[model samples]
Target chain A: MILEQTPDKSRKISWSYILLGISIVTIILFTLAPILWQVLTSVKTNEDISAIPNVYLPHKITLQHYLELFERRPFWLYIFNSALVSIVSTILCLLLGSPAAYALARMKLRGETIILVLIAVVTLFPYALLFLGVLEIIKNLGLGNNYLALIIPYTAINMPLTILVMRSFFRQLPQDLEDAAKIDGYKTISMLTAIILPMTLPALVTTGILTFIFAWNEYIFALTFITEETMKTVPVATAQLGGASLFDIPYGAIAAATILGTIPLVILVLIFQRRIVQGLTAGAVKG
Target chain B: MNNQRTGWILLFPALLLLFLIFLYPITRAFGLSLFTENLGTQLQPVFSGLANYQRMLGDGRFWQSMSNTAIFTIVSVALELVLGLSIALVLNQSFFGRGIVRTIAIIPWALPTSIMGLAWAWIFNDRFGVANDILQRLGLIETGINWLGEPGLAMVAIIIADVWKTTPFISIILLAGLQSISRDLYEAHKIDGAKPWQSFSQITLPLLMPQIMISLLFRFAQAFGIFDLVQVMTGGGPAGSTETVSIYIYSTVMRYLDFGYGAALVVATFMILITTVALVAWLFNRTKWA
Candidate 1:
C-alpha cells in the first residue's frame, strides 16, 4: 500500500449506514407519493376530490367511479383494443423477430454490429415519424379507425428491439445443443421448434412483456389513427376521459380509469421485474 | 449451404415488413421534404427541390421548436442523469428490502406517460391543485400560482413531470453499471489510502462512463422527441412555450395540413439527432468510453 492515512474510516462507515437509511426512506416516499395520491384520488368521491384544500384521503371509498367510467365512456372497448393490438403485435414481433434473430445468432451474419446499431437507431426515431405515412396508407386502404391501423405500425415499430433482444439471447445459447439436434436428424426448422424455442422462455417472456407494455401504452398512433369513439385504445381513451364533452370533466372517473389502465402493467412489472431489469440494462429494449 | 438458405429465409419476412413500414416511410418523408405542395391547397405532391428545407431555415416557429426541443432534452436528461446516478448508488448498497425498493422504482416507469401526465396536470391545476395547496399551507406563497398557465412555469412543470417519469429508467441502467464494477477494486483502493470519494471519482465514474453515455443518448433521444407528456400535461402550452419540435410538427402536419413542411421538419429533426448522436459517439470513441 502507498499510504495509510484516511479520515475516520470506521466513523465513515457508520455515517454511510445512516445515509443509506435516509436514502431508502426518501426514495420510497418520493416514488410512492404521486401514485398513492392518485390511488387516493381514485377512491375519493368527486366532491371530495375537488374540495378546497384537497382531500388527502377518500371520505368514502367508492366503486362508483369505476362503474361510471364504463357507463359514461367506451372504456371497455379501449381495454379490448389495447389488449388485442398489443398481443397481436407482440406475437408477430416474436414470430418474425425470433427466426431472424436465430439466423443472426447461428449463421453469424456479417455486419452484425451494424445491423444491431441500425435497429437501435430505428428505435430511437421520433415515434411521430411513423405517423404520417402510416396514416396515409391506412386512409388509402379505407381502414378507417380500425385495429389494423394501429397493429401494422405497432408491430413494425417494436420489431427492431425485439429482434435485438432475441438475437442477444439466441447468441448466448450453447451451439452444442443445436449440433446434437442436427445429428439426431432434426432439420433447421424442427430444431428451432424442438430445441431452441423451449430454451428461450425467459427471453421470450421478457421481450413479449416489454413489447406488450410498449404497444399497450402507445399513445400517438392510437390517438391519430383511431379517431372514432369506439376504436380508442386505453391511453387514448384515458386522455379522452375529460374530453368526452367539455362540460363534464370527471376527476374521480379519470383517476379510476388511470388506476384501472395501469393495474395490468403494475402486475406485469411485479411478476417480471427481474427479467425487465436485466433486459433494460443490457440495452436490449428501448427506453 | 442449406443453413445459409434457411437463415436468409428466416430473415426475409422481417426485412420485408421493415422495408414496408419503417424504411419505406422514412424515405417517403425525406422525399416529401423537397416539395412545394401545400396540403391545404391540394393533396398532390410537386417536387420543388429543397424549398421546404430552405423555408425551414427562415421560419421563426422552426427555430423556436428547435430550441424548445433542445431545452427540454438538455434539462430533463441532465436531471435524470444526476438523480438516476444517486438512486443507482443508493440501490447498489446492500440494504434491507432492496427488491421491494427496486420494484417501487419501476412502477412509475412502467405506467403510461399520458395517464400520469393527467395526474400531474391535476396536481398542478391552479384552482384545486395539490401543488398550490401545499405551497400555501407551507407559506411558500401567499396565493395560488398558475403552474402550467405561465410559460416558464409550464416548461418547468413539463420537465418535472418528465424527470419523475423517466429518472427510474436512467437509474436502472446506471444501477446495472454500478453493479458490474468489481467490489475488489474498491477494496484494493481502500488499502492504497484512497478515500471513498477518491475511489468513486477515479474508479466508479470512469468505469460507469460507458453506461452513462449510452443511457444519456437514449434519454436524450427520448426527451428530444417527447410528445405524450407535453401533449397531455400542457399541450405545448400557455403560449407555445413548451412546444417541442414533435408537438410543433404534429400540429403543422395533422392540424394545419402542411404535409410538405411537416416532412421537412421531420427530416430536419432527424438530421439534428443524427449529428448529435454522431458527435457523442465520436467523443466516446475518442475517449474510449464506447
Candidate 2:
C-alpha cells in the first residue's frame, strides 16, 4: 500500500511538471511569436509576402528585401546615426550622472533629499511633455538636424535613472574604502577614478547599457529634431519606410528594416540580460 | 565644509541639465500656453490669457484623445499587472533554464518601441497580416478583418502591442520583488497545511505590493504619454480612435505649428497625470495600512 501510494504521488508530481513545462512554452511563444513572424517575413519574396491566404512559409528565401532597403533608402546612414547618438549620449550620461550619484550617496550634503526628490519627479515626467519646449531650445541653439539635438536630450532624459541606479550602488559600497583612500591622500577625483569607480564598475556597465538602449530606441525627439534623411535614426527611418512610396507598401523591405534595427538590441539583451534586469529593478524599486 | 562644497560642485552639472531640460520646459510651457502663437498669428506671440484653455474646454478632439489615453493606460496597465504577476510567480519557482527564459522574456522590452510598432502594424495588416491568418486558421473569424482600419479594432491592436512590449518590464520588477521574499515564510505556511493559493495570497501579495505599485505608476505615465506605437501603428488612425495625448500634442505643435495651444495641452495633460498619480499613490498607501 505504501509503495503504491509513493508511485502515485510521483506521477502526480510529474503531471504538475508537465503543466509547468506547457505554461513555460506558452509564455515563450507569446513573447517570441511576433518577432519570429517578422524574421520569417523578412526573407520572403514580395510575391510570397502578398500571397492570398498568407504564406506561412516562403517557398524560396531571398536577401532581396535587405538589398532593397539599402538601395531605396539610407538604411546604413540611419544605423550609423543611431549608433553615434546612442554611444555618445550614454557616455555623457555616465560621466555626468556618476559624479552626481557619488556626491548624493557619499557626501553629507544639505538638501540631498530635495535633490533626490526632484530627480525622482523628473524621472516620471514624460519626454513627450517636454518636446515643445525642447524643440524651441534646439531651434534657438541652432542644433536642429545636428547630432547634439539628439545626444543632449538623450543624456538629460537618461540622467535621472543613471544617477538613481548609481547612487543606490554607491550607497551599498563600504565607507571604509573611501576613508582609507582619503587617508592615503587621494583627492575626490583621484579617489573616484582609482578606488570608488573601479569598485562600482558593474554599476557603471549596468547603467551604461540601460542608457544606451534608451538612446538607441528613442523615437519622438529623433523624429521631430532630425528631418534630414541622412541624419534620421533607425526607429524614425524604419517608420518612414512605410510612407516612402504611395502605391507599393514595401512590407518586405520594412520587415528587413525591422529585423536589422532590432538585431543590436536583441544581441544586447541576450548578452547582458542579467545586468539589464538588475539596472531596471534597481532604478525602479530602489528609487 | 570642504566636503559639502565638493558635493555641490559635483552635483551641479547634472542638476543644471535636468533643470534646463525638465523644469524650464514645464515652466515655459505654462507661459507659452497663455499666448496665442500659431500660423494664424504668423507664428508670432499674441497675449491671449486663458484663450487656449477656453478653447480646450470646447475642443472635442482634445477630449476624445484624453479619453482614449485614459482607456489605453487603464486597460493596458491592468492587463500588464495581471499578466506580469503571473509571469513573476511562474519564474519564482525553481525551473530549468530559468535564466534563459527570463532573458528571452525581456527582449520585447529592450527593442525599440517604434520598430516593434511597425512590426505590429505589419502583423495586423489587412491583406497579409499573420493575425488574420492565425485567427482564420483557428476558425475564429470567417473573413479577413481590417484590424487597423476600424476605430475600435485599431485601439485594440495598439493596446495589444503596448501590452506585449511592456508586460516583460513589469514582470522583471515583480520578479525582483519575489526573489527578495524569504522562502521561510512559504515553508512555514506550507507546514501549517495551508494551500498553495492561500500561501501565495497571504505571503506574496502583501510583500510584493511596493513593486506592483512602482510598475503601475511607471507604466501609467508611459502609457499615458504613448506616442511611438500609435504613431507608427495607425498614425492615430482610421478616425483618430487610437490617437493618444502625446500624438495629438505632437501634431498640434509640429504639424499645425500651434505652439500656444500645444503648450496649453501640455500643461493640462501634466496636471491630469500628477493628480492621477497622487490619487493612486494615496490609494496604495491607504491599502497598505488597511
Candidate 3:
C-alpha cells in the first residue's frame, strides 16, 4: 500500500488540492496576462495594435519602436537619473533606517511609542496631499527642483517600515552573538559593522530591495518635486511620455522603457525574492 | 548601557531626517491649518482657532470624499484579504512548478502603480479593450460594458483595478504567514482525522491572524490614500464620481493654491490615518497581550 490515509485525511487533501489548483491557475493567468500583453504589443506596430481583430501575436516582429525610444526621447538620461536616485536613496534609507529601527527595537526610551506613532503617521498618509507644503520646505531649504527633494522625502517615508523591519530582524537575532562579539573585545561600532551586520545580511538585503523598489517606482513625489525635465525619474518621465497624447502615446516606447526600467528590479527580485517575500509576509502570516 | 549610546548615535541621522522632513512638514501643515492665509503670503498664518475644522465639518465635498473613501477601503480591502488568503493557502502547499508560479504571482505586486493604472485604464476602455472582449467571449454579457464612463461602474472599475494590482501583494504577505506554520501541526490534525475545513478554521486561520491584520492595515492605508490610480485611470471622473480625498487635496494645493484649506485637509487625512493605525495596533496588542 502507498500509505493511504484514512477517509478524512484523504478528503482533506483532495479539497486542499482542488482549491490550490484553482488558485494557482487564477493567479498564473492574472499575473501573466498584462505582462504578456505588454511584451506582445511592444513588438507590434500601432496599426497592428488598433486593428479591428486584435493581433495577439505579431505576424512580423520588429524592434524598431524599442530602438526608436532612444532616438526620440532622452530615454537614457531618465535611466541614469533613475539609477542615481535609486542607488543614493537605497544607500541612505539603509544607513538611516537601520539605526532608527535598531534604536526603536533595542532601546527603552521614555516615549518610544510616540516615535513609532510618528513614523506610522508619515507612512499612512499620501505624499500628494502633503506635497505643496513639502515643496515649500524644499524651496526654503534651497533644495527645490532638485533630486534632494525626492531623495529626502523618499527616505523619510520609507523610514518607518525599514526601521520596523530592521528592528524586528535585530530583535529576532540571538543576543548571544552580540555578547560574544563584545566579550571578544569588539567595540559597539566595530561589532555592528563586522559581526552583527554580516550576520544580518538577509534582512539588510530584504530591506534594501524593498526600499529601492519603492524609490524606483515612486511617481507623485518626483512629479511634484522635480519639474525640470533633466531631474525626472523613470516613472515620472514614462508617465509624461505616455500622457503626451493618446494619439502619440508610443505604446512600444512606453513598453520598452517599462521593460528597461524594471528589468534590473525584476532580476533583483528574482535573486532575493525568497528573502523579500519572507520579510513582507512576516507580519501577515504569523501575526 | 554603553551600547545604548551607540544605538542613539546610530539613530541620530534618521532622527534628524525625520524631524526636518517628516515632523516639520506635518507640524507646519498643522500650523498652517490653523491659519486663514496661505503659507506663501508675507503674513504668517493668523490663528483662526477651530475655524478650519468648522469649515471642514460643513463642507459637503469633504464628507462626500470621506464616504467614497470608506466605501473604497471597506470593499476593496475585504475582497483582497479573502481572495489573498485563499490564494495564499493554495500556494503554500507543496506542488510542482510552485516556485515559478510564486515568482510570476509577484508581477502584479511588483508593477509600478502608474503603469498598472495605465494598463488597467486601457483594459477597461469602453471599446477596443481586452476586458470586454473576454467577458463577451465568455457569453457573460450580451453588450459591452462601459466600465469607466458610467458613474457607479466607474468606482467598480477602479476597485477592480486596485484589486487586480494589490491582491497579489496581500497573497504574498499571507503566503509568508502560511509558510511560517509548521507542517507538523497539519500532520497532527490529519492524525486526529480533522477535515480540511476544520483544520483551516482551527489551525490556519488562527495562526494567520497576525498576517491578516498586517495585510488589512497596509491594504486599507493604500486604498484610503489612493491617488495615482484615480488620477491616471479616470482623473477623478466621470463627473467627480471617483474623487478621493487625496485628489481633492491635490487640487486644493496645486490647482486652487488654497494652501490653508489644503493644509487643513492634510491634517484631517493625518488624523484619520493615525486613528486607523492606532486602532489596529491596539487591537493586535490586545489580542497578543491577552
Candidate topping lDDT = 2
Lowest summed lDDT across 10 adjacent residues in model 3 chain B is found at B37-46
Q: lDDT of all predictions, in order shown?
A: 0.85, 0.93, 0.78
Task: Assess the local accuracy of residue A60 in candidate 1 as a C-alpha lDDT between 0 and 100.
Answer: 90
Give residue A160's lDDT in candidate 1 (0 to 100): 82
Please state the CAPRI-style docking class of candidate 2: high
Interface RMSD of candidate number 2? 0.7
Clash pairs for candidate 2: none
The residue-by-residue lDDT of candidate 2 on B1-290, one tens digit each, is 98899899999999988988899899999999999999999999999999999999999999999999999999999999999999888887789999899899999999999999999998999878999998999999989999999999999999999999999999999999999999999999999999988988998998998999999999999999999999999999888899889999999998999999999999999999989988998999898889
Residue B87 of model 3: what lDDT?
78
| Global Cα RMSD, each model | 2.7, 1.4, 3.3
TM-score for each model: 0.95, 0.98, 0.90
| Candidates in order, interface RMSD in Å | 1.5, 0.7, 2.2
Off by over 4 Å in 2: A1-8, A243-245
Error of 3 at B34 (Å): 1.9
Itemize residue pairs with steric clashes in candidate 3: A284-B211, A285-B177, A285-B211, A287-B210
Candidate 1 on B1-290: residue-level lDDT in tens?
77778888998888787766777767888988888657555867888898898898899988987898899899999999999999999988888799989988888898999989998888888887888999999999988999999999999988988999999998888898888899999999999999879999999999998888888888888898899999998889878899999999899888888888888888888888889998997988987933
Better of 1 and 3 by TM-score: 1
Clashing pairs in 1: none
